[model samples]
Target: MGSTVLDVVNLIIARVNAAWWWASSGSSGPMPL
Candidate 1:
């Protein structure tokens, strides 16, 4: 159970970082692009 939660948290962090990087790219309007 603890490991599962930790994995999920890591996944969420990766996704958020990717989205942030994309948004920082000026020409992008939003994420999911």
Candidate 2:
């Protein structure tokens, strides 16, 4: 149970980081296709 929770938290953190990176990058310039 502890391991499963840790795995889920890691996945969520990774997704949030990706989204943050995208937002910051887009604000700097237009996104590429």
Candidate 3:
């Protein structure tokens, strides 16, 4: 049961990291005309 809870927490962290990465990368550069 503890293992399952740890797995869920890890998954949530991974998802949040991925989203933050995407947002940072998307805004780091300027738009092209």
Off by over 4 Å in 1: 1-3, 27-33
Candidate 3: where are CA atoms >4 Å away?
1-3, 27-33
Candidate with best lDDT: 1
Between prediction 1 and prediction 2, which has the larger TM-score? 2
- 1-33: candidate 3 lDDT, tens digit per residue: 467988999988988777777677875653322
User: How displaced is residue 1 in candidate 2, in Å?
Assistant: 9.5
Q: Each model's RMSD to truth, in Å? A: 3.3, 5.1, 7.7
List clashing residue pairs in candidate 3: none
Considering TM-score, which of the candidate structures 1 and 3 is the better prediction for this target? Answer: 3
Question: Clash pairs of candidate 2?
Answer: none
Write the residue-wise lDDT of candidate 2 on 1-33 in tens digits. 467988999988988777788787865664322
Give the Cα lDDT of each candidate: 0.78, 0.73, 0.71
Local accuracy of candidate 1 as per-residue lDDT tens digits, 1-33: 467988999989999888888878864765752
For all candidates, what are the clash counts?
Answer: 0, 0, 0
In model 1, what is the error at residue 25, expressed in angstroms?
1.5
The residue pairs that clash in candidate 1, if any, are none
